[model samples]
Target: MAADRLSALPDDLLQHILSFAPEREAAASAVLSRRWRTLWRRESALDLDIRPYMAADEGQDLRNSPSPLDALLSDAVAALAAFPRRGGGTVLKRLTLFLDLNDVDSSYDSVDDPEPVDDGRVAGLLADPAAAGLEEVLIGCEHGRMRTTTYGLPLASMACAATLRVLELESCNFEPPLSPRRAFPCLTELRLRHCFFKEGCLQAMVDAAPALTSLSLDRVSQQPPDSAFQAMPAYCWVPFRLRCLTATTLELKTYSVGAEEEDLARIGIELDMPSLRYFRYTGDAIKLSLASPAPGLSSVDLNASLRGEQSQWEPTSRMLVSFSSTRALKLHVNCMNDIIYGEEEHGGAILPTFPNLKLLELDEFFEYTSSSAALAMARLLRSCPVMSELRLNLNMTRWYRDDEPKTNDPARSPFAQSMDRFNRLASMTASSRRVSELPAVLTDDGAFTCLQTSLRKVTLQFNANELDCFQVQLAKFLVENAMVLEEMHVDDGNTFWLDHLCNKLERWRADSFRRRNLTDTARFRVHHLE
Candidate 1:
């Protein structure tokens, strides 16, 4: 520039601009000149990513070794201490600390072999007086097989709780106080993932964080209730028993739900968040009692191992009734028995119509490929009177219907051995063809009538199983009835086949008329078979 515009600004403005840079870059700016050397030190936030420690030690097969994180911790503490205070007060507000034990995205080890944190880095950070002004702390510790059990939770109210507004803890043991009466007075968002807690500890934390508006617990392990606590009542040990919380959004996933095979103690749930708007759960089929219906709840996701037993399926019935006002419903079921459809004993109960539901998703976990499966899928679609979009994910080498979209990642590539064989054997001169069971979904003109459907866009992914009656009929029905249909995607699962199934589609169909009309549709794209 003609007059050095950046240097023309005041010192305060220069320091503010440097604060936006990464911590390392902020420090490096000092090498530019004497003017920038001291500007980086005035930043209010300390975002530290301590990953190089473990990255350097990778493939060494080190176990139970002293944590390399200790040095980084000391550096953070020193930085916090060094940040100058005006009028004898701290200015630190945000501290995002990510302590990764191993490289999850590019890990060579099959097992999660994490090095233990033997240093006093974490404790020093929490206890430091300079952190009194910290309002947000996103601290995560991921060890392959280690947790900070000895330290428990460094969350005493006296330490930064009064000033903390957002707290996220991962892989940390949470021990509850006798009665959490005055804790996290200003906290609003709390997330605990892969954390260990005693029976009463979770409830105690919820009771303390009265101002919480959002809460998420992923893979949270709740220990068996103590003998003294077990005798109290069933609700005492419940994982998500939030009687006092008025949070509007909640996501909870349990690690242990006692079934036949596991030796884990039985876990119960009782949710009473009247203001909850979004609810997501992933766990075994342990029954949960809803204290009241979330009138404002618009989205729900239920991932469970629903079996033939009534106990597991019964809760789903209650959830359907409770989430009647929900606009979107997603079900990720492990076991797809008739019981999951509320067929046996719970079918008689009149389930409310999902009047607001317009989008439905079936998880890839469902492997049922039959007429009954179609009916089961239609049952949900029928309940949602105005459903516009439906996404299906087929997990078992075909027909994938799910609540969430699968990303384009090599790790998630669906390249199976069967696909390889199908590719090599498949050609314009077909050798062997196997037909799949035809599902008479539309034959019964009662519950599911595609002619009167409100579907606008449909995306289906399935393994090309002979492209038989079921697949053809389903495709034809969608092209005809979906008057408002915008786009249709038919994906074939043959990721890395020596010979592609798509290349042999013309030969396999045989009938020229069928082949010509089959691909013809409104905004249709048969995804290339990889």
Candidate 2:
């Protein structure tokens, strides 16, 4: 009955159904009945996963016999070749092969040098003019090394399929002198992950694909030259009209002006794309500048780490000025401490001004004095007139105090009297009085109130025990300012003030009951972990 139902479906629908099944299962389905025998062959998209097939053939001791890896590769190539061609001679729309070639622990010797698998049979299939109609190809394999002479995909044998648009290669290698010369004029998207190329091979590949629009390169390395470091050529002058680019672990040894110039020149070079928005670099810091401003860019993430006796402080600071159009910016400065306080320091005033900026996050390794921090905050608030959110994650673990006391230190007296003075100061500060209005001795409470008004949400994830007096003052300020606040979450872990907070929230608004009722039916729970 199941077979009958499957057969009743239209040819297109049946093909779609069979495409979802594994290659082995799809092939086995043919034996279900006569009508289903050729159904799998009609699938336009072929997905062959070799791991399960290899694992199921456990009884075949090919290790002590002929090479199992070679046999497996041969079987896969043969299966693809056996697929029937369409009336117009087209093979398939797409072909995806996912393989896991990791060696089992059963062997003591290294399997790195597994016998070479001849891909001539597969190359012959790809070379066929009828099979050239394939539009997309994805190949993913496990971690392994390919010989310098062994090319995984034979470009010479591959027919120029104008229909091919997308190609992805993961954990694969291309042999040296890999000049395929075949132009993928219609190809737009190319992704290469954990793949290696011979020197000048990448440039050659990029030159062949003029229509490339989106390119993702991750963990791609080139063979080192005798000079130790040499700048690789910028292959894509205008890669397939590329608009989105993500590059990681691009190892370049030499620093050349053209390398930087070419990179910056292509900032807003897209001719066909208006939605090209993201530009992300997660590896080594490249000294590339923006050519034409990226006025359309909404967000930019730049992570740069440079090595040198001289500081990259000035150059980095200057580079930021180019990204004036970005509304959201995340910058990770590697040598922040060294550069910020160096002898020839470019003043912190060099920090870029975000005119239309609303959200800002600063992750720094610096000790921020209360006065310095306040000044910096004032400048930012003044600059970003519409700013609504600010997050500062600082590492202040190394702050130390001098043994010599300041002039304002309390007299060496009873502990209770000293505590009384401190509490009084806290209370005065948390009262929200103007900075000029602060008395000769400011209270901790007055200081807390002043900070509370500027922040909608403030989270302190460090030790609060040392700032107990300040915490108490801040808690009182929260209670008083509860009307202006929409949400107040305090995670002091010191339960001494939790009850006070709960009571304050309960009495401040009767809407708390409404929130409790809504919580019962909500699918998502906002957990406040203690």
Candidate 3:
């Protein structure tokens, strides 16, 4: 080569290559070539994570660590100060700063009013004029046990909110901007997890962000908005704005076991998302309500926990019908059977039929083998009209669709209704039921409808240590009932021990059966109990 290929590239291209790389890898790039040495310093993003290093050394306690002007804070401050002051080619586009706190006074002063956080070095960087072009910023911290701690970050210190596109803060308290000014205009995405806002600042920031497209409020504080704020005006209808929201992705998780549930009122009681595509909720099922039908939703994950008294809560399957249009759903609840079957724990309200569901995951699936569980499960199986894939957590049982169709049992009467159609010759004396009896039952029987589709896969979780009759029966039932199954993958998760035992049992059976016959020429085939 006439010249080195790396040295021939312009400075701008090299800076981009370094900008996209991780902070550690970018530091290592200096050894590649002399020209690439200083290019990392000129990159557009500065993502510095010093938490691991600090956690490893374990030498400096929070009360005794070097001041923000001396340690990790100083490095961040210096990096911002030296970030290219030339004719303006590449400015700071993104900044991510992560820190860990081992104690309450982790190198920052403790205050009671605004927040308990202290980072003078970050404040110093924000005050510098070089940070005026910053577009995105994420400041996250980790406490010992994820305990709530408010960080004192003055909005006035950050002068780049007008240009900021994404802002995410965790374990901190954020104060709104001062009066006689607008707030975060170009912001598109905002994620607040375990963060606190000053009085009235929460609603003010929501009203000010004119271009927000994605918002996630996971366990956000329940503090009421301030009645008097010098910087922002009031909205008479805040819930309506949330109902008519246009964001594409929204995640809401609430943990109301603390005093906030008793003191603070619930905000945004009904979700009015029309443009939502993905959703996840993980706490307190009794708190959610649908403002209108969410026709655009496609994915949902519900980690439901019942709080307060079950008698006071209306366990209506109707609330979940809003998500009938979803393509995938993961449900983790202890009382799901109660909702599906409308038992004594929950009112006897049958869930509506879902015509668009494809993949359904029922967490704690092995618990559905008891009389109550089986009855509830039968009801659920009869409601998913178009479901194709079902994931269950099976702990070694030979249970199948028809293993114990307890038609005589009062609890299993709903299932007997579906099985009756398959065995209609035994039930109806006229050879066929009247025309009207067919539609009301067949049109609503999901188990009968599932057999008509292209259900080809049955995946089960089992164990080698506890093989039972249900394991074999489930496979037989799927092969016979599904009618079009092509694959049945069982993940025993114990390294094929069950398969080994099945082989040993099969060999033993064959030997014992062959010994019983007087003739050695007699051919024998043996089936294992497993």
Best by lDDT: 1
Residue 216's lDDT in candidate 3: 82
Candidate 2 lDDT tens digits, 1-530: 24556557886788788877767788898888787787777777777776676676688776575344455556666666665543334367777776554543222222122222334544454566545778887877666443211225555556644677887876455553334556677777777765556555665665566676566766454443324233433122211122222221121122222333333322312222233355554533443445455566666566554445333323444445666556665555543442232324544455456665545555444332333333333433444444444444433324422321222334645555445445544654433322121112222223322233333433322222223223333344333332333444444333223233334433423443354452212111111326
Error of 1 at 4 (Å): 11
What lDDT is reached at residue 410 by model 2? 46
lDDT of each: 0.59, 0.47, 0.57
Better of 2 and 3 by lDDT: 3
lDDT of 1 at 56: 62
Best by TM-score: 1
User: Positional deviation of 239 in candidate 2, in angstroms?
Assistant: 19
Task: Please report how far candidate 3 places residue 146 from its true position, in Å.
Answer: 7.2
On residues 278-308, what C-alpha lDDT tens digit does candidate 3 reach at each position?
8887665443566666777778887765555
List the candidates' TM-scores in order: 0.71, 0.58, 0.69
Name the candidate, 1 or 2, with the larger TM-score value. 1
